[model samples]
Target: MSKKLAVVTGATGGIGAEIAKQLAQNGWRCLLVGRNETALETLRKSLGEGHEIIVEDLQDERAMAAIAVRADALGGTALLVNNAGLNQMLPFENTPSSMILNQLCVNLVAPMRLTQALLAQLKRTHGTVVNIGSAFGAIGYPYQSIYCASKFGLRGFTEALSRELDGEVQVKYLAPRATDTKINDMKVRAMNEALGNKMDSPELVANEFMTLLNSSARRRAIGFPEKFFARLNGVFPELVDSAIIKQLKTIKSFLGTKESSL
Candidate 1:
């Protein structure tokens, strides 16, 4: 039989690359999907042989269909990590319509569509679908309006699909606190530092992801205060709103600048 395969989108990013490496080390062949062909080739080489690369932008519908076709042909697809995502840090009022649409498409729609396309293969192998969400998914932040909405949608989709496919496939959501990746720019980093927010490393997130794969838990949010606040916000959102209101000034100070996407 062919080896079990793991298709990981955004495989060129910090967290995504680490996830691919960890999966490869654990004996699961990886199909690294991202828009960067050069970086994908470099990552593929680092992971040794038996792995593959899918160089396509998640914003393209054809990319998702092509990925589904490739995964089906490869067979034994045991895992799909919907890790590709986009974020813009500007204030909602300052955010452009195009950026908002892009974020929603990449962070939410693409994952939903890709998972739907791969459902049959996943069911065949009783595979798992892990959506990489963010702390903002549960606790909305000041400058991340669109990003929060996208991630929140992803979390809801994962919950609904988990129940819908319960016995046939495993659906999980993993929320990581702000990680020290290129995704966060200098202004974003400064804001986090001013707010005393903890920024976890990509390695830490990858390790937590491995733990999630091994556990029976349906959802796991990483970090100390982040995990606490995600649950707290779920139960009492008003309280979270109050807390965020206090940090609004600091968050806005970084806003007026141009947004960056990774």
Candidate 2:
């Protein structure tokens, strides 16, 4: 019999690697996708057995098509973790046009297209699609405007897909709060520190993510207060506005730092 196959984007490191590790530990074969072949190979080897690797830039328009063909070669996929994402911290005015477009493409459009491309395989295998969104997506943080917009778009896409494919395939949206990864620049880290924001390590999140995947729940928000705030903001945007408005000074302090904004 064939092993249960899983495809994970952004699988070379950080949360994506951890998620893939946990899935493999639970007996799912992995197809790791990322931009670096060496990194993908490193992760594929670390995963032990029953795995493969695909080196492709998620920013490319052809990525969805390529990922679909790779999935076909695996027979089909049992799970699709759209874990690839771009995280940046910068003021709206400082963000370059090219950077803005790339952010949306990687964080929002890529997942949307990937899911569309893999819908047939997902339906046939009763597969699950896990979109890794952010608390920023729900609440729209001060410095990361474009990042927030992309996540918000992703959140909406996930919700619509869940409703559209409810019984045919399980679509889930998992929102994680500030995570400890290279994605966070030192300036961003300092702001989080100043604000006393909680940061979840990739391992801790991967563990919780696995639990969420096993349950019947269609969506979940990781981290308290962030989770609490996401729901609260949904019901009362004005209340959240009042709260976030107070953080402008702190957010501005980190804006001019020499950070990649990626």
Candidate 3:
């Protein structure tokens, strides 16, 4: 019998790479998908064996198609982690048209396309789909309109798909708040620091995320106030709105001169 396979997008760094290592340790064949070939090779070499590297941009129209063909050749994928996403720190008004489009394409569209391609294989194996979302997806934050939109869309996709596939396949949404990764830019980091927002390490996030994937939970948000805030905001929008309004000044202090979209 062939080993079960797990596909992790953005596998060259941070939580994506950490998740790949964890899955490999769990006796699963890993497909390291990323845009950087050199970084992908470096990570692949560090991992033991039964791992394959797929260097491709998640934004590419053909990437998911190529992945589908590759997964079939590798004896089918038992797990799919849509971890490839980009973050920007500009205010809405300052956000460029191109950046907004790119963020939408990478963070939201790519995951949908990739999952669509793997649905057949996932159904055959009772496989799991994990969408890496964000705390912003739950609570909209300043200077992250585009990022928040993408994550929110991802969360919705994961929830709808989970019900749509119910007994056929397992779908999970794992949201992490303010992860300490390269995904955070200098200004973004400064804002988090100033605001006293919590940041989780990539490894820590990956471990917790993996645990949820292995369980029966459908969706989980990481971090303290973040998780609490997400729920509170849902039931009491005015409460969250007032709290966020108070932090607007502090959050905006870290923004670059050009960013003023809020």
> Number of the top candidate by lDDT?
1
Ranked candidates (lDDT, high to low): 1, 3, 2
Report model 2's TM-score to 2 decimal places. 0.95
TM-score of candidate 3 on Cα atoms, chains taken together: 0.96
Residue pairs clashing in model 2 are none
Give the lowest summed-lDDT range of ten residues in model 3. 253-262
Ranked by lDDT, the better of candidates 2 and 3 is: 3
Off by over 4 Å in 1: 256-262
lDDT of 3 by residue, 1-262 (tens): 3379999999989999999888877777899899899999998888887789988898898999999889989998899999999988876877899999999999999999999999999999999999999988888877789999999999999999999999998999999998989999888888888889878999999899878977899988888988899999889989999999888778767774542444
Lowest-scoring 10 consecutive residues by lDDT in candidate 1? 253-262
Residue-level error in angstroms, candidate 2, position 211: 1.2
- My TM-score estimates for the predictions, one after another, are 0.95, 0.95, 0.96
Clashes per candidate, residues 3 or more apart or on different chains: 0, 0, 1
Better of 2 and 3 by TM-score: 3
77, model 3: CA deviation in Å? 0.9
By the TM-score metric, which is better: model 1 or model 3? 3
